[model samples]
Target: MGAATAAALVLSGCSSPYDGAASTDGRSPGAPGTAAPSRPAVTPTATAHPPNDAVGRQMSWMLGQMNTDPVSSDVSSRFTEQFQAEVPPAQWLVMLGQLRAQAPWVLESVTSDGKAGSASVVAQGRRYSLTMTVDDAGRIDGALLKEGAQGETATTWPQVEQRAQLAAPQVSILAATVGDDGSLEVVHRSGEQGVRPIASMFKLYVLAAVAEQVRDGALSWDQQLRLTAQDKTLPSGTLQERPDGTAVTVREAADLMIRISDNTATDLLMRAVGEDTVRAAAARAGATHPEGITPFLTPRQMFWLGYGDAPQALDARAKWAAADAQTRAQLLEQVPMPGPGPENIDMTSTPWRSGVGWFATPQEVVQAHLYLDTLAGDAALAPLREILTKNGGIAVPDWSEQAFKGGSDSGVIALSFLAPPPQGTQRRQALVMIGTGERPVDEETFVAATADAARLLSEHR
Candidate 1:
């Protein structure tokens, strides 16, 4: 559920001379009284100046491209030739599209460090720090956009939990570690057993089912499926950008769904494997409220259900939920699809509380990951482990093997990680972080707390 942004990497070969002023003893060269014979006034060597405005100019061009044709070759021209060669324009456009979906990112400030600089950008009520490097010609060579650090100093697990509770009174956080021996240990928790909205973390169950089918020979890893227009969902994926009828193997789809949390991929895979399979998987995984996602939703469907304005939409959803399997299938065919643009859904309100999304408890969430790990042995789970490494946002250096899946929508945010014990140790560990409230949770604070929780668990282990 996280929107991805494009970052530019620049390699510049330029240096600026220091602007130190040269001084002579204020005494006249010849004598106090003699106007020193006018020698050619030494023209101060023109100081080579740093490209202080390079970041500003490059950002201006980037903003313009974002406003105009972000997908065009012209937009790619803003980047250095080498950069464009290294990264495809289509990939750039995909990232730009995600940014466009969350527009009005205002420039806060820019600070320079030699040829490199960092820009603070604010959008969607959050601040991100974008770092960029310029080439000698001033073309943007590289840039990266990520969440801005909240200036708060680091604190211990107890302090983080207390502050998180105060900052988000409605959020219930749970932090626990499970050793290799399968011992579940609670480190810090509040409202740990509450069934709060888990956003995309529910996909773990769907993934488990898919893996099970592969193991049972019910589905082949190489089975190819077409991407019809109807299967397309919103951001956090590349599938939507692909042309209709594009073919992808079952294994590829599952990787995208879990690695990037692609909505369209999830929907297509769910449809392909059958929703009943995923439901049963969730139940087997120890989900306390599998019914919360009984009628699993694609990203598009979730948006329509949570934000669509048509009155009958809610009625249809209600009937679908209450209907039997056959009747629900019939009603699902009649469900409305949302148009592409800003949604009318009031995110600040408790839309999730209306039961339009998925929900699960902390222990259940952890159990789901552990269940999947057990069900899919090392060889079968290799692909899952491979893709999970792409999750650079949540990586911790000390852990030998780490896998993560996180979700966020409006007032809900959930992060789950499975880290195996260090070499020569039999203990493996899992960490789950959940936050929800009537209002939107502060992403910076929540992320910091999660990092602290992970560090604490690692230290204790």
Candidate 2:
């Protein structure tokens, strides 16, 4: 609530010659770059500096607002702009309270001197630095924070190695790697390796399943088919309302399912592949929850199925033995589906039907990519990657060589990429990010998280 409490006790010792301890014209020190004389005084300026009162109150209000929940982008941006335009001189406590309250789930510690300050915040389960400086007033003069590490924390051999071994939150990255020998590899999860629902990421498996049929002569990408009522299941990809009674090729369906994430197209492909086959393929690829289509069942369907079969389907469950009820429910319910068939189809309509909603660890995600790559080589991986790497309607050039898949269900977000390293680069990287919380999943956060993770892996390679 006060600057003294927010700042570290005994803040005076942390100083340097450039820290400005004197004043000019025989007055006590007041501003930067002034060679003023020093004087022992009891009362300092109540406001910090520059645009003092306005800035302090603004920060105070920002900190107060954060007690409700994490600050939304709109809230953060508004405060950021206002604070910058009208900064305070000595409102360091306001900064501490604001950062801590705004990201309570992430921030760890905060400390400040009159000049420079630092705070520790957790992101993706790893600690990161947020450093800033204050002018004579308590407004932020400068600030710096990165999604990754600043430097090694330890000087000792084992400590340094251990620090190096630590994984950032973004390490859940999934990607494809091309080696020096032209061989492709995938690296999925980097830390706390655990199995997570792939959601739409499982669509890659559906794509691979279809590709397998193509390789075995059971199906052809160019083959055409009718959009029957049976194909109107929930979560169906591009198989939505196409020209009614119009015909389209299997390749086109695959393209829309992978590229546009079309739900109806996904449903048709699923029916073609059969739920059993898709589950089998997913299991072979090490998917932990291979119930596949079952996870996308409606609540009533889940009730009828006893909720024990596809634990990932229902968005809420009161299990006799478990704590991840919300997560399990989110994993199950968030999957997309299409409308029911015309034969009295009464179940909840899924946005993307033929798609997969199975749970897989980030490693399983990489393995899924590998399974597909092994079958049709780069060709099968291409279309999906093109759409996913676009980062939501915007094209990114570096992603041209990247073939990947992305999935989102409620609070869960997943991405699996298989791409060539930039020209002349050898090692490949897999980046996966899985977020399961009550917080709304923003697409920009996903893209930024993935990009940051990929950059981290690239730097080490």
User: Judged by lDDT, which candidate is best?
Assistant: 1
TM-score of 2: 0.48
Worst 10 residues of 2 by lDDT: 16-25
Model 2 ranges off by over 4 Å? 1-192, 233-238, 284-357, 378-399
Q: Write the per-residue lDDT of candidate 2 for residues 121-192, one digit (tens) a residue.
A: 443233334455545545444554423232344433333223322322222433446564434364333444
Tell me how candidate 1 scores on lDDT: 0.62
Worst 10 residues of 1 by lDDT: 16-25
TM-score of each: 0.71, 0.48
Give a tens-digit lDDT track for model 1, residues 263-333. Answer: 77887788888878988888888887756775776667776666565765667556654565566455556
Q: Pick the candidate with the highest TM-score.
A: 1
Kindly report the root-mean-square deviation of model 2 from the true structure over all alpha carbons: 17.1
Steric clash pairs (candidate 1)? 8-142, 8-143, 9-141, 9-142, 10-141, 10-142, 180-427, 180-428
